[model samples]
Target chain A: MRVNGAEVEAAVDPRTSLLDLLRETLGLSGTKKGCDQGACGACTVLADGERILSCLALAVQYAGREITTVEGLAGPDGPHPLQRAFIDHDGFQCGYCTPGHLCSAVGMAAEAARGVPSYVTADLTADRVVLDRDEIRERMSGNLCRCGAHNGIVAAIAATYAAGPGERA
Target chain B: MNPFGYARAADAADAVRLGSAPRAAYLGGGTNLVDLMRRNVVAPATLVDVTGLSSAIEERPDGGLLIGAAARNTAVAEHRAVRARYPLLARAILAGGSAQIRNMATVAGNILQRTRCPYFYDVAGSRCNRRHPGQGCDAIDGHNRDHAILGGSPACVATHPSDMCVALAAADAVVHLRGARGARVLPLTELHRLPGDHPEIETELEAGELITAVELPPLPPGAASGYRKVRDRAGYAFALVSVAAVLRVERGVITAVRLALGGVAPKPWRARTAEQALLGAPADPATFRAAARTELAAAVPLRHNAFKIELAERTVTAVLADLAGEAR
Candidate 1:
């Protein structure tokens, strides 16, 4: 299996989640596990560039699949734009849920840009979903930040809206 | 988790053969099964992985979707044929656990996911008829808010928590099952059995049988579909009162209608009476309201779940209204 573009093989329990495999087995703790039950956004990661709850993913299912953790969010630079924006907007107080929030925000913004309709999207079949406060709140409803930094997180996401696909405006 | 031997099945036949043993359990994505194993709800001696099954999403010549049982919820929802034909199913799958869970959770697994009753999860010497047959039902008189209002026996009232099953029932889908004895197709609505004499026997699935596929019939022309669910929270929560509606209206009259209610029944509650009422009536608010009222007429709510009947009625009416607008 590929973790951050590197192939690694280690003995994993059949019940081990991808989050545990990355953090415990592979020694990559960048992916935080706030709620192991998939309630919080702390265990969010990208599988083949699509955002998913890592805490709910089984490690055995990701054979030869690409997994991008928070450690891979940087590109030899100091940080990704979402990460930088989180800093600029003071997106974290305790910073426990920041990684999952950042990953989910990136995926949500990409989905919105690609015209994926969500629950709050007025038209279910609409091509484009406008990202207002309500849309942000509804689309990111699966990811919760207990630190009360949602306002800042929303600001950071709004800032990256126009930049499009991995770019921060 | 207890250590268990693992074997990946080559196909459906192999899966059934391996699962024939009482100690072996078929494993799909391991989303729910793994969680249950960690919680010690289920402890199988052997795990048979079925991820190697074919991923083909075949469209029947009669205009139906032949979804492989192993098909991930995400793939089944995003398939072009499914999206264009059965939008209700796609919508229901999208409104489940999470993106990751959907990616791993198979259609068969979703249908077979265990009950979410709080007492069922409390395996620490708790009494649950579904868990331990004949032990007794502790939920009948205690914390019955999420309990079923329909098709519930005195033994158990645990609600089946699959959003897709509700839509499947409304869409008149068929479940293809393969076992050591051979293959058979059961109507999706009849797949789940009422908790009658035996609450332990939840579904009609025979021993060693594996769900191979779910077959969805073609939608009628001008058929509009909708899924509406009210839960404790907005996203990622089980349905409190969910309604799946597929209605066809012609000249302001409901030509045909299929209604199924979730979270209000032990199985998917097919609103046959309500559908019959709307068959030749106007697809307006008044008719939909009357039909919704007729469906909840037989609801026997518990002390704490009296609100579910009214909530389900409103949900049914609201979905009917939304679907009627789509038909026009």
Candidate 2:
């Protein structure tokens, strides 16, 4: 599979998960394994730009896909825009769940840009992007912050993305 | 997880051919199966990756929708056709798992996923008949506030946990299946079986029979639909009681309606009795309440889950009333 923009190859056990392949074999530990079961969002990673839980994903099943982990968020210039906003907004305390939250928020921005509707969205007929506080909280419901830094995290996400029209200032 | 061989099927025929081997299983996105495998609930010898198969969500010529089995929950929920015509389906999918899980879970996996009964997952401590037939069910008498209140046998009271299937059932969808015996179709409402003496036999599909697609039939004229779920939290939790309804009313009277429930029965329950009760009744809260009562008249609740009886009634009533209001 392609890891972070580079093509890499490795032989793996049939039961090896994508998370294990990245952490154990490929030496990318930025993607933390919290629950290993799908309950926790700590294993969130992007495959072909869509967020998925690497712990439940078998490595062999995603042989030809492009995977982006927390490490891929930065460019040659510096940290991604969302990363800078996260630091400015104090998005973490102990900093354990920040990686998953950041990755999930990145993917969520793409989803919002493409007009994915959450349960809280008032209209479901057409493509609509309203990245308000409620929408952000609903979209980021999967990624939990145990350190109770959600207000700042939501603020970081809101400040990073342009809140669509009709959003509160 | 246990070691297993994996192969990606080229198509339906290839999947059936590769899956004909004993102990071979079809792997969708593996949100639930992988978790179960980690818990040692299921171990298959070979896994046929059918994600390469049909994942198309095509518009049928008859104004219905044909969703391929491999279509991700996110795709189907976000499809323009589903949002415009089948809002119940789109809403149900959104009301389901978190964004990551919905992105990974497939249409077929959602239908075939197991129950969330605590006893069934407690492989190391609790005895569950669904896990091991004849082992006796601990939920029947133990702490089972979430167990099924209807259509459960003494052997098992586990409730099927798919929100999408309930909407499909309400829409009168049909499931397409393929196996060594060729292809066949069954109503979505009849696909899952009620837990009888054999709670382990959750589905009617024969060994190696793979679900290829689900076809949602066209709704009646002027029918308006919606899905409502009541859970423990505002988001990201299994439903304690959910109602999906498609209703048509004319001149303040019910003309046509279809109802299905989740988190209450062993399968996605087709609320036919409730529909019959509301067929000609006035479109009002009283009519909805009467129909809900008729539907739950046969429900037998467990000790800790008696509250489900009232919750299901109120939810069904509220959902139908909302849909009826939309129609009028």
Candidate 3:
């Protein structure tokens, strides 16, 4: 099976979730286990370039899919633009929920490009849900921050508004 | 988690065959099932995977919508026809668990998901009738804030957590089930039972009876529906009080209405008294308040959950007001 674009073959339990594979079996500690349950977004990762809760995802279900963890976000040269914005904005304190927040923000940006509507979308029939404070707060409501870094995190995301279009749907 | 044998059911017949086996459970998205298994809450001997079945949303020629059991919550809520015909269902789904969880969670699993009582999730052998039939209930006098206010008995007080289910009950949706015997349909309102003596038996579904589809018939003209829920937290939490209301008005008078409540009952609480009060009455703010009071008059809340009565009334009024506004 391929993970994060690499081909790796090894034995794994059928019941083992993707989060277990990342933190325990494969030693990808970047993905924190805030709740183990899907309530908290601390264990989020990108599956086939779409954000998903790794804690609830079964590893066997992604036998031939691409996965991207926080550790895999940085290129050989440096961090992604969103990562840099996060640091510049001090978007993390304890940093437990940062990975999930970052992944969720990336996905949110992509969703905005695709014209998906959040609860904060003022006009229900609008082609795109405007990326505003209220919209981001509502869309990212699932991702909880223990240190109350939501303001900075939202700022970091807002700072990248001009980074051009991202993946949609 | 205990080791449980796994079996993949290729189709409906195969699933029913496996379900007939003693202590076998049907696995859909595994969002709730896996969580329960890990906590040792449920120790099924065999898991029959029913996710492989063709349970997509199918549009009936008569303009009704048939949601398959395998359809994910996200897909069902986002379906074009569901949005146009039944916005209440879509709003309820959006008000449920997070997007990632919704992506993997199926409509069938949402209805069948077990209780959210903390005592039930307690793997340290806490007293819970739902977890252990003969054991006592710690929530009777404990942290009962999230407990039910209606259709509850001394045995249990855990509230059903599905927001979508509340809307389904209000819409008069029919639950489709498949078993070794054959296919059958039960009204969504009858799918659940009061706690009474057997709190362990939550829904009317028999052992190994798999839910295949849920059908929602076309609503009457001028029919408007809305769901309102108030929780301790804003999002991703179970409701402290919730109400789903569908109203049809003609000539400024309420023609027909269906109302249901969640997070305040063992099953979705249908506000029949409220509907009866609203029938032939003018659709005004005062009339809505009177209907809400009538529905909540018989509510029996525990010490911690007494606040739910007021909350339910307020939620019901607010939902009705919104529907009335949409009609105008």
Candidate 4:
């Protein structure tokens, strides 16, 4: 599998999940394992630019796919805009779910840019999806922060979204 | 998880051949299967990965949709054609699970997903007839707050936990299946079976039969549809009760209506009696309430789930009311 712009292969058990392969084998501990189930989004990652739970994904099933984890968000110059925004907005407290929140926010921004509507999107007939506060909360509902940092996370995501596509990284 | 050999099928025929093994399962997104495997509820010796077989969602010549079985829930929900033509389907798909899960879950697997009864998931001590036939069901008497109140037998009371399937049921979609025997088409309503004497058997598909695609017919003109789900929370939670309704009214009279319910039965419950009650009647709240009551009268709730009866009625009434407003 090609992960984070690098080709890496590991001989793992067929039952091993992608999250385990990233953490235990590749030693990428940024992705935390909270529930080990798909209920929690701590293991969220980008598979072909779509956000998915790595905990429920089998490693062998992602053979030829390109995966982007939390560690892949930064550029050579500095941290990604989402990372900087999170820090600026105090988007985390315990920090266990920060990686998931950051990665999910990236995918959520792309989805919104593509005009995907959320549950709270009032007008289905509208061509453009406006990212208001309720839209941000509904779009980022997958990731859960135990420390009650939802307000900060929402603020960070809104700031990053306002930064535009050219200033993302 | 238990050790299992994995094989990625090259095609539908290859998947059928490989899935015919003694203890083999067709793997889709691995959301439900992996969770069940971790809980020791099911242990397959071989897993035939069919995710690569097909993922196309094309518009049919008849102005309908032909969705490949492997199409992910997120892709199906976000498709422009689906959102424009079948808004209820998109809404129902979005109402389920979460963004990450929808990104991974496939349409076929979502239809075939198992129930979420506490006893069925409690593989350690609870005795579930669906998991272990003739072992007796613990949910029938034990904690059954989420159990079924309709179409439930004495042996099992588990409810099918799928929001997408409920919409498909309301839309009258067709399920296409392929196997070593041959290919066949079945209506979405007949895809899943109720817990009769044989609670173990869930779907109508034979062993090794693979769901290839789901074909949805074109919606009638001037039809307005909607889906309403009342869950434990606002998002990322299973529905305690859900309603999917389609209504076409002309001159303040109901011309046609289709209603399906979730979280109330072993399969997606089609409110046929409710549809009949509303057909030709005035599109009013009184008719909707009467139809909802008529459909929910057969509910036989357990000690804890009796509230679902009222909830289902209210949800159905509310969805119909919204559709009526749209018609006006």
The candidate that achieves the highest lDDT relative to the unseen native structure: 2
Model 1 clashing residue pairs (backbone): none
- lDDT accuracy of residue B110 in candidate 2: 95
Q: Candidate 3, after superposition: displacement of residue B318 in Å? A: 1.6
The lDDT-based order of candidates, best leading, equals 2, 4, 1, 3
What tens-digit string does per-residue lDDT give for candidate 1 at B34-71? 77887788899888888788667898999787888889
Instruction: Give the Å error, residue B230, model 1.
Output: 1.1
Scored on chain A only, each candidate's TM-score is 0.91, 0.94, 0.91, 0.95
Can you write out model 2's per-residue Cα lDDT over B161-262, one digit (the tens) per residue?
999999999999999999999999999988999999999999999999999999998888799999998999888889999999999999999999999999
Writing each residue's lDDT as its tens digit, candidate 4 over B29-146 gives: 9999999998889999999999997889999999999999999998898898888888889899989988888889999999999998878888888899999999999988888888
Model 3 over residues B108-164: C-alpha lDDT tens digits?
Answer: 899998889999999695899988997989999898888988888899988888999
User: Using Cα atoms with residue i matched to residue i, what is each candidate's TM-score against the true structure?
Assistant: 0.94, 0.98, 0.94, 0.98
**1 or 4, greater by TM-score:** 4
Off by over 4 Å in 2: A164-169
Worst 10 residues of 4 chain A by lDDT: A160-169
Per-candidate DockQ values are 0.43, 0.80, 0.44, 0.76
Interface quality of candidate 1 as DockQ: 0.43
Q: Root-mean-square deviation of each candidate, in angstroms?
A: 2.2, 2.0, 2.1, 1.3
Let me know the DockQ for model 2: 0.80
As a whole number from 0 to 100, the lDDT of residue B77 in candidate 2 is 90
Interface RMSD of 3: 2.1
Question: Residues A1-169, candidate 3, lDDT per residue (tens digit)?
Answer: 5565677665777678888998898888888888877788998887766677888776765666788888877777789888998999999999999999988777767756765555345443355456777777777787999899999998888777534435321
